[model samples]
Target: MPKRRWLVAPPAPSTFSARFPQFPPLIAQIFYNRGITTPDDAQRFVGMEDVAANARIGDDPFKMNGMSQAVERIRRAIREGEAIGVYGDFDADGVCSTALLTEALKKLDAKALPYIPHRINEGYGLNSDALKDLKEKGACVVVTVDCGIRSLGEVEAGTALGLDMIVTDHHSVGNELPRAVAVINPKQNDDAYPFQEFAGVGIAFKLAQALSDAQQQSPLPNAQTLELDALLDLVALGTVADLVPLVGENRTLVRRGLARLNKTERPGLQAMMQQAAGKNRSMSAGTIGFFLGPRLNAAGRIEHARTAYKLLTTQYPGEAEQLAAQLEATNRERQKLTDEMTQKAREMVAALPPGEFILIAGSPDFPEGIIGLIASKMQEDAYRPAIAMTHKDGVMRGSARSIPEFNIVAALDECADLLVRHGGHAAAAGFTVDNTKYDALHARLRNIAERELSRLELVPTISIDAEASLSDMNWKLLEHLDQLAPYGYGNREPIFLSRNIMVKSARLVGTEHIALVVSDGVVVWDAIAFRQKEALPKLAPLPKQVDLVYTLASKVWQNEPRLQLEVKDIRVADL
Candidate 1:
């Protein structure tokens, strides 16, 4: 592991506690450190959007460029009893969107059918064969979720075959937009919607809201039970899994969705929760990202996504139980494959020169399904951008994961002429290149990495949000910090950097973790640093004094709750 470069922001205003008179000084400092300075900003940051917390609950659905038109077409389909097919991608977000929209349309009286392409065989987006099949099955309108922003050719194919498309996606748009009945993407060039970072399921929720509004005015039969809030369970799963920022409407959605997820009435969700040992435990964004999302995504990674799809939407108890069990088994297989690939890829990269800017490893023997997982591990191990590829039938399909300093998708877009198809976000992307262009693509990407990565320090960094001591710790302080719950990619947990800590005892646990007993001389705190056993050598020596960056966690054992320091990083004290 490389040494980490610590980054700390400048000191907060001394009058923060005076400006926000409702809280203590410590809480006010945290608000300021998090960029919430004003009373109104502090109110909203803590999800107090009711009193002075109004920081834009959610953007108006009608403000989106084509939302009104899409609503009109969807309303017509529901009234006429047309077969509405929802085309979805093969990821967790895609599955959740498909399930969400399908359930929404079903309540609105449309015979909505979900059509998810197989990841291994059908690839991604709306393929022509599936579109043709849906049309042959008497489907009149097709809506895409989490995909189809770049499927101009397939959209045209469907239109020529008399299939009307309503493209609802959140990915980037290309030079030419798809010709469809209505395109409801916030990222559209003409869209003035204030927030453009909605996940695919977030867009679907907007459509559902429009449908609910139409239902209320149109004297629909099920108008009284259109609790779109219930569908928020789907939104939370997808939003958290998609890695969208949990700041504004996304935060409001996840906070509420997590509540519903913890007490979800859906048989599938209930069974899966019970299977994952979540009977009485609270569910947070981290819970979904770590446990639920992986299980939902395991099917897509190995074979077909339809298994996970059925697991989420199924209403029968027995079927839900069976699907949940299948998914658990599949997830285990995914983990095994990922570990096996990572080991092999490690050896492959070990042979490369130490000064290489990027880690690119591939083999014909590698399974295409686990390439993304392999790339992710390599990026973490080397603290540099990494790409893992698999070769089959004159084509190379690969997944790339990048650090904060590099944008892999932009790099792929810059060298688009050397690839067949590519699309993704800043930190991760997937692309396909011809076998003959593999060397050229690798060379071009390496050159770009050389120009970009050569200038930046290659060590990982831990950002400290505030400075505090053990004397300030108390139950009330922990309660104040609890307001910032449901943290994820954008909204992270707060870390405090405290100096002059003594390490009394340190022991290795589970091969890679370190359990420590430390003190600020007045109070002793039990700390556990996961995956940082190597730091024991630096701490076990005589000096004893060290600087610690850590988050406070409450651990319960035998009905006793105690505060534990979850160590993030440590270094010798600045004496």
Candidate 2:
């Protein structure tokens, strides 16, 4: 792995800190780093104040462009007893969106049919064959979740088949919007929605909220209703898993959703927790991202996403347990496959002459499912944009992962003529191309990356939120930071820098981790440096002094709760 650049955040001005007298200086500085400048904003961010009321128009689902039209059409479908198909991508975000919307529609007595495309066979997003299948199964209306923003042709084909298309996606929009009945994407150029970073499931939740509001105004006798909060578990799962910025409405949703998730009565989720995490383990954003999300996603990456969708929606405990076990096994297999392919990809990149702006690796033997994982590993290890492709039968499918300096999707857009289908966000994207165009596509993307990134430093950087003394480490400080729960993507855990700490004792923990006891003379703390065993030689030879960048966490060992430093980076102290 490339050594990361450390960028320490500048301290907030004293005048700015004076506005929030209640916060500790450290807490205030951390909040300022997160763009929380005012006392009111701080209170809202920490949940001391009502987030929804302070959200202006952002919390109101109807304010989103095309929301009203989508709700009206969906209500009409419910009233007319027309079958509605909820089509979703294969990833966790897409699967959760499908389950959330399908459950919500079913609550309103709508005939909801959920469909998630297979990763290998059908690929991502809306497809003509899937749409036709839904139509044949009596679906008069098809609502796309998490995908379809760039699928103009697919939407047209569905519309031509008399399927009223309502697209609810969160991906970056294409040049022209799909000709659908209603397109509910906050990222649209003309959208008035104040918050635009909702994950696909977030948009689906908003649609459900709108439907619930509509239902309340006009009574549908004998129609079942669902509490909006009930669906938040799914929202949190998808929002966090999709890696959307957890700020604004997304943060609020995840905050409340985490609460729901910990107490979720969904048998499938409970079973999954038992299989993956302990049954008693509390669900956090980390839990979802590291444990639950991967297992849910493993189904899509390995086989079919419907297995995960079923696990989320099933009411039977027995079936949930079975499905959860299957997912666990599949996730393990996925991990093994990813590791093997990533090594292969690294070898392929290593053979190239150094200093390439972007790394491209392809193999005929690469599994279609884990290409994205391989690309992500390559990008992280190399600190450059990486694309992993798998070729089969004169066609190629590639998944791209990019650094902050490069927009992978935009680069793909520049080579549109060479692609059969392509869509994604700034940092990640997927594309399909004929084998004949693969070389041209790779060259065009490489040129685009080089032109955009040649002038800049390309190394990955670890951002340090503030500098703190070891004395500042305590339960109180950890509690203050805990207010910023459900951290992911945009809203990250605060990383603090503490310099010249003595490593009193150190030992290797796991294969690539170091467990250490450190002190700043008067204050001693337990710390763990993950994946940093290679740097052990620098800290070892005992009582070595070093500068450490880390996050604070409370962990239980031997039935006791203790403060532990989760080290992000460590370096030798300057003489």
Candidate 3:
């Protein structure tokens, strides 16, 4: 792995600290680093103040384009007793959106059928076969979640089949909009929604909220009214898993949703929590991102997404337990496969000519489901935009993960003619191309990345929020940091730079990790450097001192909770 560039935030002005006297200087510096300058913004960001009073224009669900139309269409379907199909992708966000909407609609006495396409067989988005099946099952309307914005052909085919399609996606839109009954994407050029970074499940939550409000105003006989808050647990799960910016409306939603998730009554969630041995741990964004998200995603990656959807929607404890165990097993298998494929991908990239701005690797043996994981690992290891593809028959399907300096989706857009289909965010994207066009597509993408990234430093960077000494590692500092709960994409957990720390003790925990006790001459703290076995040689000399970048964490040892440093990176101290 390449050495990462450390970018530390400059210290906050004394006046800025004075404005928020209640918080420590470290906390104030973190807030400023995140662009929270005013006292009101800082208070609201830390959850001391309510967001409802300071909500943006996009906070109102009705303000979203096509929201009213989508709500009315779904409402009419419920009133007329027409079957509604919720079509979703195979990822966690898609599954959560499908489950959330289906549950919400069923509560309103609507005939709702949830459908998630098979990852290997059906691929992504609204497929004709799935639509035909839904229609044959008596579904008159189909609403898509997490997909369909760029699926112009699929939407057209569904329309020709007489299915009224309502697209609720968050991906970047293509040149032309789908001719669906209603299109609800905040990224639309004409949209007035202030915040445009909602995850697919977040948009589904908004649609559900609008429907709930409509149902409340005009009571449906025998209808069980749904409380929107109950659905936020799904929103939080999908939003965090999808890597959307955790700010503005997304932050507020996750903040409240995490609270609900901790006390979730859903049997599936309860079963999953118990299986992960997290029943006693406080649920946070990291728990969802690392533990819950991967397990939920493993179902789709290994087999079919229907298993995960069932796990989320099931009410039976026995069934939930069975499903959770199955997911656990599947996740283990996925990790193994990813590790093997990543090694192969690295070998392939190593064979490429040096100075290539992008890394591209493909294999007929690579499983289609885990290509994204391989691509992500490639990008992380190489510090460059990376693409991993699975070639089978006459088509090549690929997933791309990019560095912050490059937009993978935009690069794909420039090669639109060469691709059969493509869509995603700036950082990640997926595409399909004919075997004949694969070479052309590869060259075009490499040229784009070279043109764009040649002038920029391509090293991986770790942004440190503040600099603190070993003496600052205390329970009170940890408490103050807890105020910024549910950290993610936009709001990351604060990382501190503590320089020239003496290594009191050091040993290898695993093949790739190091366990150590460090001190600043006055105070000592336990630290763990994950994936840093390469640095062990430098610490071999006893009493070696080094600069450490880390985040504060609490670990239970001997049934006692103790503060520790989760080291991110290490560098030899200056002589």
- lDDT of each candidate versus the true structure: 0.85, 0.90, 0.90
Candidate 2: residue 436 Cα off by (Å): 0.7
What is the lDDT for 89 in model 3?
A: 86
TM-score of each: 0.95, 0.97, 0.98
lDDT of 3 at 571: 88
| Cα lDDT, model 1, residue 327 | 88
Model 2 Cα lDDT, one tens digit per residue, 128-164: 9999999999999999999999899999999999999
How many Å off is the CA of 478 in candidate 1? 1.7
On residues 1-575, what C-alpha lDDT tens digit does candidate 1 reach at each position?
A: 77888877566677666898877676786777777878978777775442122122376788987888888887787778789999998889999999999998887778887999987677767899999999999889999999988888899999998988999998877667899998988888889888888899999988888777767667565434567877888999999998988877788888778877877888888888788755765688878998899888888998788898898888899999999999889999999989988999999999998898999999987777788889999999999999999988899999999998998988898888998878777898888899999999999999999999898788898877778887676677777777887788888887888888888888899999988888888988889998998888988675488898898878777778888889999897988
Q: What would the per-residue lDDT of candidate 3 be over residues 116-213, giving only the tens digit for each residue?
A: 99988988777889899999999999999999999899899999999999999999998999999999999999998889999999999989888877
| lDDT accuracy of residue 141 in candidate 1 | 93
Better of 1 and 3 by lDDT: 3
Rank candidates, TM-score, best first. Answer: 3, 2, 1
What are the candidates' C-alpha RMSDs?
Answer: 2.4, 1.8, 1.8
How accurate locally is residue 528 in candidate 3, as Cα lDDT from 0 to 100?
97
